[model samples]
Target: CNPIAEGILMAHQVDWLRIQAQIKLCEKGRRTGITFAEALDSVITASSQKSAGGMDCFYIGDTKEKGLEFIGYCAKFSRVMAEAQASGVSEIEEFLFEDQDESGNTRHINAYRIRYASGFKIVALSSNPANIRGLQGKVIIDEAAFHRNVSAVLDAATALLIWGGRIVIISTHNGKSNPFNQMANDIRDERYGDSAEVYKATFDDAVANGLYERVCYMAGEVPTADGKEAWYKKIRNAYGPRKSQMREELDAIPRDGNGVCIPGVWVDEAMRPGREVLRLALDADFVHQALYRREAYVNDWIDRELAPVMAELDPELRHFLGMDYARHRDFSIICPMSVDMSRHRDVPFVMEMHKVPTRQQQQILFYILRGLPRFVGAALDATGSGETLAEDTADEFGHNRIHQVKISRAWYGAWMPKFVQLYEDGAITMPKDDNLHQDVRAIETVEGVPMIVKARSQDLKDPDLYRHGDFAGAGALANFATLEVTSGPVAAKSRRPRQGRRITQGYA
Candidate 1:
């Protein structure tokens, strides 16, 4: 190896990254020299003969400028190691390539290419380019977490693996929910069956690997241990109070963004592991049938399923319920929250059901309200298909006891902060469920307002669980209910009379 190339590989992080793996993924700190080291590896691969396992390399970045910068590293590696190579790196060239949009519309792109003395070459590509699907070669996706469609890019990259081409994915996390972070985690957990190699390098890891000393060296100053420590401290201090940013960018910790409605740390802290929790699972068909003939099946369900669970709750504590209604596609999350006002702890009990009829949901909610020792207030989602059920619940419970919440940008903008404050102040506790954790993380800030992602999907085998942020929405509603009942509890209203308002509506 050339001295420059050898020096580049001398970094411990670089050495870890250089291990020969067909599928390589790196969760790295920002501004570390991992990408630079990757460029040297690309040079070595592209400059070697086919008999030596060399292949044409494709470098994809989040932007064309990043492509240029990566190619610049390759150019430097070529210059410093030309005599050592059997097939030397040649001059960089600019060319136009025809690229296509997602809609099959064609456009020309200015791409940078570097040809080695061997038949192999390296090309730099912009993010999410459709033309990548048409290419067959070793793929290097840089800053994958920041790509517009990282999942789609990964799909394209994996296609090349069938032909024995390699794939290298590297980026710091953008959010906890980003596909790149999830894939890296899956690989680390051995979900991919040990074919892939995983590399994790945080800011601290790079610093221990001589990152600060290298910075001093790059600045043309003699590197010292004390000077390196000072530089590291100064860099970390620049991100004060924005701990999520620091964690995501430097610590290699997964963070959705600053606008996430709830901090993942808070959720983790609030989890009551191994605690007894109730989950009532009901299918759509059974719920629908039970609703029409409530005396036959629905009543039995409440007694058999809901009653035992209700009995387990703390009888003395005041309870409030939040219901986000969805009949199909998304789960209807009903969160029953108990507040020990004296202790100032809000313990939320999670109940998620999907594809259940609105009538069964109403019956379930009615039973929950009737069984509670002290029912403060309930907030029911009244958006779109939820309107009828919400209104029915409100009519049954009265305006004093039930709030028919129609969610909007203004609604989330005003109330989400309070919900988040409950988490930040350590006033909330939830059950230990990974799906619920993901729901909390799915809430992102868009244009200074907090909202759940519209197109977000959870990777669950259950199609009903493929919701954006059902639990988060219900959690927010539950928090909102606490604000509605300030002084004391109000009795639920009824249609006929307090006595006649049980399950029978006297309907034909």
Candidate 2:
């Protein structure tokens, strides 16, 4: 039957069927009808002639019940189309499916099948078969995230593409660390080279396309606006207090370990174009040159890049600074935050230094600190090599104004949430840059603490370089400074007491 003309298929279902890619994946919400759409597609494919792209279809669900459900859909659809097409569709046959492994090990799996007159059949395996490569056709893996070995199943599915077979993967997110979520990310990041595509369907997206109405019709209840609202609320409230789980299951957002702490959309919304990200890279030989030469080289860079950006800061606003320090490999990031009357934090500019000597880094940092209008306080990363710089800066600018932060898990637990809160509350804005975007996206939850992950992404501008969330750490520290540091103008302090004699008081 023509489900589309009958309005049986929703927009997302139709859109899914329209994609004829070799490999397509759907990361969807629970009960979004993706499996139902796949069942119809499987029936049509199995009924088509060989010249019209007919082939055997395999449905691999995580459990036996799911297999039965899929096979039932195929049976129903096949019988519906039989009268119109005059095709012979057989009854659902329960039999043993022979599965073989790479080592020639063989086993029998419980399977259900529906044969068609076109010599093609649709088979639903009760479990993930070891010999997926052995059956070549349109392979549909449902609830892929719940599979026993997600990575192994995905790896085997790719082999079907060699024989012009199409593969379809559909599931709701399990977690950020699940291979299913990772695969979706890989496709978005273009790791699959356009061979695979990922389609996302959240609960809200389905409701927008008449999911609630469909539910009402199925339940034989009249649909009303208030009823739909209450239905949505009921479903959301079902997972009360478990916000992460609710978001993952209903919103298609992945949570738990290794899940992205800051989504790209949030980062994109907070990013303000036209802001500057000053970069200074010094050669190894440049550091070995005479001290004056090194000083002059960095000074020129400061004048050309940093001076213009700092000149625009408002003197009336209180400013704070955070620095994540590095000497050679990773970037030493400096983030300066300006707080306005509305309590919004605006990062006027970000400064990144690579392969620069300690003295030069100090020179650039001190310049930015001094140039900042109404500078209140600054936080510096004091871990390892960073200690010397943090200490020196504290000594130069008063201990009360410069905080020496030693980053640790406890520290992250205390401060990272506040940093994340800045973005969540829309209280902060930063420069629009791809490298900075990658840096912020690197923050992931580990053991219940939010911190940067060990795995790094390559810099978009420089292929040879990688980022370890330097900007994110610095931004976090800068945010910490704003909360901890007393807000006001900083009093200038000299290195030494005045050597000259002091004037006597009038009374003396």
The TM-scores, one per candidate, come to 0.52, 0.53
Q: Which predicted model would earn the best lDDT?
A: 2
lDDT of candidate 1 over 97-205, digit per residue (tens): 7888668899877788999877899998644467576666678888887665567888777778778888889988877777888888888898877678888877887
Give lDDT tens digits, candidate 2, residues 267-320: 766899998898887667767687876666666666666777777888788999
Q: What is the lDDT of residue 51 in candidate 2?
A: 97
> What C-alpha lDDT does candidate 1 achieve relative to the native structure?
0.74
lDDT of 2: 0.85
Worst ten in a row by lDDT for model 2: 499-508
Give the TM-score (vs. native) of candidate 1.
Answer: 0.52
User: What residue runs in model 2 are displaced by over 4 Å at the alpha carbon?
Assistant: 1-258, 492-508
**Backbone clashes counted, model 2:** 0
